[model samples]
Target: MDRRALPDDDTVATALALALRAPSRGNSQPWRWQITPNSMHLYLDRSRSRPVIAGEERDVLLGCGAVLHHLSVAFAALGWATIVHRMPNPDDDDHLAAVTAVPRRPTNQDIAMSAAITRRRSDRRLYSDWTAPPGYLGLLTERAAALGAMIRLLRDRSGGSRAFEPRPTTQGWAADSAFGSPGPYDLENAAAYWTTSTHSEHAPAGSAAADEIAEPDHADLLLLATPNDDRLAHLRAGEAMSAVLLTATNIGLATCPLSAPLDSADQRLRLRHDALDDTAHPQVILRVGQAPDATDLPPLTPRRSLAEILSPVHA
Candidate 1:
């Protein structure tokens, strides 16, 4: 492959095609792309976000974030290293990310993740009642941390609507890297810049609400929480979600995104007060466990054609 400062039209189109497989709420695939002279831009196509109660669904950020990571994985597999600029435009909320693809040899790890994208599926069927080994859970946390987010294992859900119980995860955010990274929503000065409008890291702990946890079941649930609950944070959580899901798929595991539970304002409030101790905002709860049989994974869900997601101005 010829080296180029930025990938050309065909190369970008190829990656975008693969990126379309990124998971979204109900496979809504609410995102758009624009390949400019020097970089590829990602946007939230709000028209397809599928708002529940009101406007501008928050899960759209996560969906876009998944596609963002998927794009990077595809580029890497195609022998290109992408330097991503997340939230490049603070003035425009729709502009979620801008990625520049630099041609380079792909690594083994890159190829693995890219391959996982195709094998991955949202398994809504019941996951096997197996405890995910600590080693695998560590890898899942690492994947989330790599993208400036974190994951915490929730007490296994048997199917109760009670507050999510903390399973005591070993993952923590690298505040330095997350805040140091470029673009808007910098967290270096988090004290001054961020507020606890959503969920908080400083809420009171040991409350009566936090102590009540239901019994365990056949589910392995992980909460994809972020330090801040802003749109940018939601997007980062989405990217982390994609990485965790892909990692799980690569290692022979099943995943189901449980965003519907938190859709209710009351449920989210209960989770914050009861489960997390209000220490972090829960973006999405993922059910990760072994499928009954690896050979019997769910079939691939339908996706929009490349033409639908790409900029209409271009071919």
Candidate 2:
């Protein structure tokens, strides 16, 4: 009898490479994939975590969750099915997802999502004042609802709206500290993106400069929220956010995540009073609209190498 062959390393590498292309907080790419015959493990890279801004392991998990989303879609593209077990062991330091493989056929949504992985980028450009279509909002809401989250649109009303607000509970900051920096703060490897954009001769000065460079003040914004503001909830929110963004990208819409408004305490309070049912924590506020030209800051951050990030303690 002939011996059965195992999955080749090249095949594994290629599949993983495709999955790892998911967009991160600042393209920090703070994740690692370990492939085994039976399963693929998604691990959070400690070096890529941002404890300060994320606060209590939420942001890091959110980043890893994005990778998980990518991996699931990519696996389907490869005709390999995946069952994801998120944070299987609470005691484990960096493990995020355990993806067990199964044989299955791909669906149209899977192929579409996989195809969109590479094209989706966090567009920071201001939109052309075009309103989102009625059904588009419903689609996004349904996507988030699938992940046990909610999507609320913080429309810019006549009296000024503050719906998606973030409260800064961390020390040494007056809320919205992340937004104050004018860059992707706490992003492990955003140096390249930040440094390049900052030093660009074409860059402008101060708040106006960043906005001028980013072409701000034009996109229609939407808020992504969740009940029970916990670390796991935040991770789920991230996954939902990624899914919504991908769907938007597939339809030729420009999207940017603007946590700035939510990152503010005053805004958060005002928003809570206005939007949620007095028991919701806003996770992300994303801007979506039509922009013929979407400008984005360069993602030039240095990330910790895989070796530095992953320590093989498997015995």
Candidate 3:
């Protein structure tokens, strides 16, 4: 699966479309793809911004950043030499970067990540009591490190108690943290983000007893931490977050990236040694594990039509 062999425009377009399917905050699909003969440019469409959670545009940029990483790997597996130029403009905040494609021999990592695209999905259900192989966890930590982010793997114990703990304040406070967290993509938001859907899927409400019993036996929990807690750093962490998730997807794993605890000062402090200050700011916290059963989650979420996302101004 090399790029030079499949130099057809349609082939590249298909690959770009697949990369665009990477999950985003609120299922916002806050990314655009520009396919040219020589390169594919991925941009962040600011008009479709999520105002609430992504108040500062950090989450939006991070979502686009993740897809950028996905596109790079997708093209590489297709044998394209991918070169990404991030945040090309400080003035034009919407434009994230351009990914130029060149043909090259694909690496093992490229193939693995590209393969994972078909398997990756956000599984909200509790995990089985299976632990990931020892070295694999270490490899993921190093992977996050390469992108200026840190991955804190949750140790597997009875009850898998190390998973994210919601604040026991009022019910609304607990609900806010749970629903607002990065991992769970609610159906209501998804309906709004997309123009059309058949019907809303509803599941039974869980009681506290059900919640307590359904322990999360994830293989690992990773926290996406950055050295500097700034806009640029958050964007970089988002891009790195995508890489880690896609790589995990490719290697036969299910992942859920949670941001609730990271967003909360009290919650984050309890999770981290220091407060949310200069040293680290949690952009994303991911739980990775084997699914109880194979997931039928959609292979890819629908994205805005390219015509809607791209601009005449940029062209």
Candidate 4:
């Protein structure tokens, strides 16, 4: 394959389409793409950024990072390898990352992960009590480490494995803690938080409070972290996150990305001290387990159209 061979318009569109499937906070899809003959520029759609939960743009950058990784995976599966230059432009803060695709033979690993893209679902419902296989969590950690991020397995006070815990009632969450007033972004996060955290009669059939797991001891909690906290690190963390999630899907494990605990400075600090032992900056938490067989998996969440997010490269 010729590294410089320009992919057809349809090919470019197809790759970008797969990339947009990358999950974001509240499904805000806070990203834009510019495609040229040689490269794809990833930009943060500031308009879609959630000020309430992502006032510092941390979540926005992380989401963009996931898109960047997804683009690379899509291209690789289509016989193109991507060389990513993150935060390449200082003048354009919104220019989160640039991915230059070079023609290459797709590796079996690449194809497998790409296929997992569509199969992967953020399952918030209660996972089965079955424990993840012994070496499974290590594989996920290795995947993240390959992408310049670290994965820390969180343990309970009794030295047992702990997973998704319900949002504590005493934990202070306000509309204006980091951002003022309720906006679309705030509303979206709040609604998602409520839907996942609470277990009321109106809750979806299989839905249960995160803390209500019958076997919390069997749950696997992995924290994605980086040595430093910055734009590039957050972007890399997101990429690592996508890798882990897709890999989990390929292996038949159910997973969900948790970000609420890392949204606030206080919460993040506490997590660093308690869970991480003040070692690395935690980026996101992942809940991993075997999904129940009795319940049917939910359909994939909706995504924005290609026309709504893609544009031609400007001179």
Candidate 5:
């Protein structure tokens, strides 16, 4: 690789800026980057890791993987090829990946997916009732597989609706409900409650009702899983997640990556046995469909500045 082909510090900085846009749990943005002349290193910023929501740092690792994928895509768009080594430092668990960029002829897919990175957003707003076109989900599955992950599509008719039902509990709140018996609608209702409560101040008077929209009947639930439930698998799942999201956006679909349901150990077990039938370990669930026509999309989530996330590494 010609050293001249490697991106300058400024170009690398810009790429890191775009990569930081990758979605993270609760917008925690738990990652750090060290840039040398020839390569960039990805690290898990333990200080920013949300232990409460991201036990064992699974989601944190996934988020870092997303950023890694985004960086690769960004470099490819800029006529560079990226070689990534995952978990490159066995001695330092915080070191997630090392990526080196070399000059290459950019492909059309690279440019398109790079553009999609900015377009993709985790839109939690309710999707329109329109169903996805036939074979769209298949394309998403193919994309994920190419990146070493599997995607399972769960439709309403295929017992997918029951997959998210709150588990029976012997104790308070039935584990899902704020009160009363938990049912299929419990999770949906709880979601609505949280959305309403969180965004109430920004909502217009009498518009609280708008937030009560139930999960769309036409949208499909996508389960992103890996064969192994380890750190490397989680990282690959996250990369697959970034690919899936970018592909969905490139083709003009609405998507929201949901991590809450799989946060707890019990929920993960239920998801594996009940939803996926033990085929694979579920890492995250994505709600995907078409956005309502003439509706204003939510603003993009805020991201940490590049200066805040990147540091120079001395040789």
Candidate 6:
């Protein structure tokens, strides 16, 4: 077999470019990548992270996980197999992973998912009515499962997923972390349609909202979870997040990762009883649906430069 595909300088540089496109809170890009002679190191840049609560830093780790997965996918697509050692140093929490790329032929799935890196967009425009075949969602579940995470469909009593639409029967939440305080809203017909509850008061203005007016959504609500709520579990959830999202994008679905409302443990416990019966710790709530007209899709979110996020590995 042909085995000429080692990750040289150009390949590593290209892979890192694609990988850095992974999503993060407020586009914070809370990660640092350092290149070595034979490996790429992933680190959690605490300085770049902006945890809403000092104690709850799952979002930051999850973002790192997404980039980690993206890097792996990028390497695979570039004809190299990735050897990933997650949390390589127990003593150093910042040492997230050490990845080595081995030369090999890429698979069809690898090429497709890698191409999805640039195509993926978190479009927040109002979705028109849509339906995904059971297999489509099942594939997504499999992708998440492959990375030690699970995706639970947040369906109502009728066994159907709920959209980001107001419901008079349920309580509303109106908190935007950027605004520093929870804003006002209509309790009877709240605008924070997708990601909030009575106790959640720190979600962003776009994802959850701090007032009664915001974007309208008719997308499926999916709770992405893992077995434990520790740092590693959150990171795995983020990896699974990248996998599922890329798969969704590859299959013509528009995706959005909502991290709020469930930002608080109280809200998560409430959602636990309301949605899942398992003991999994929820990390991200993904909104999946058909993309709106090309003209209506929101502009892409900006990103950090390669120099800002990448550097040489320190001894």
The candidate that wins on lDDT is 6
What TM-score does candidate 4 reach? 0.83
Candidates in order, TM-scores: namely: 0.77, 0.75, 0.78, 0.83, 0.82, 0.82
Model 5 lDDT tens row, 1-315: 656535887778777787888888767788999877666889999888875353577778788888999998888888888899999999999899988888899999989999988887777555566656678888999999988888876443222554554232233223433433222121112222122222233333444333443343345678889898999998898899999999998888877776655656897898789777898898877767777652577677788888798766766
Please give, for residues 128-154, the per-residue lDDT of candidate 2 as tens digits: 656556688788888878877788877
- Which digits, one per residue and each the tens of the lDDT, describe model 6 over residues 1-315? 744434678888899989988988767788998877767889998888878677788888988999999999998998988988999998998999999877789999999999999988876544546777669879999999999998888742222544322222222333443344333221111123343342134444454243522433456767788888899998999999999999999998888777755656676776665565646777877777777674455566677888988867557
TM-score of 5: 0.82
- Any idea what lDDT model 3 has? 0.61
**Residue runs of model 3 more than 4 Å from their true location after superposition:** 1-8, 35-39, 154-168, 171-219, 269-278, 295-300, 305-308, 313-315
Worst 10 residues of 5 by lDDT: 184-193
Candidate 4 lDDT (Cα, whole model)?
A: 0.72
Mind giving the per-residue lDDT tens digits that candidate 1 earns over 183-283? 11111011111111111232224422122212122556677788788888889998899999999988888777766546567667767767678887787
Clashing pairs in 1: none
Worst lDDT window (10 residues) for model 3? 191-200
Give a tens-digit lDDT track for model 4, residues 141-160: 89999999988776322325
What is the Å distance of residue 86 in model 4 from its true position? 0.7
Give the TM-score (vs. native) of candidate 6: 0.82
Model 6 misplaced stretches (Cα beyond 4 Å): 1-6, 156-174, 177-216
lDDT of each: 0.71, 0.60, 0.61, 0.72, 0.72, 0.73
Give the poorly placed runs of model 2, Cα more than 4 Å off. 1-11, 156-207, 210-216, 260-270, 294-313
> Which ranges in model 4 have alpha carbons more than 4 Å from their true place?
1-5, 155-218
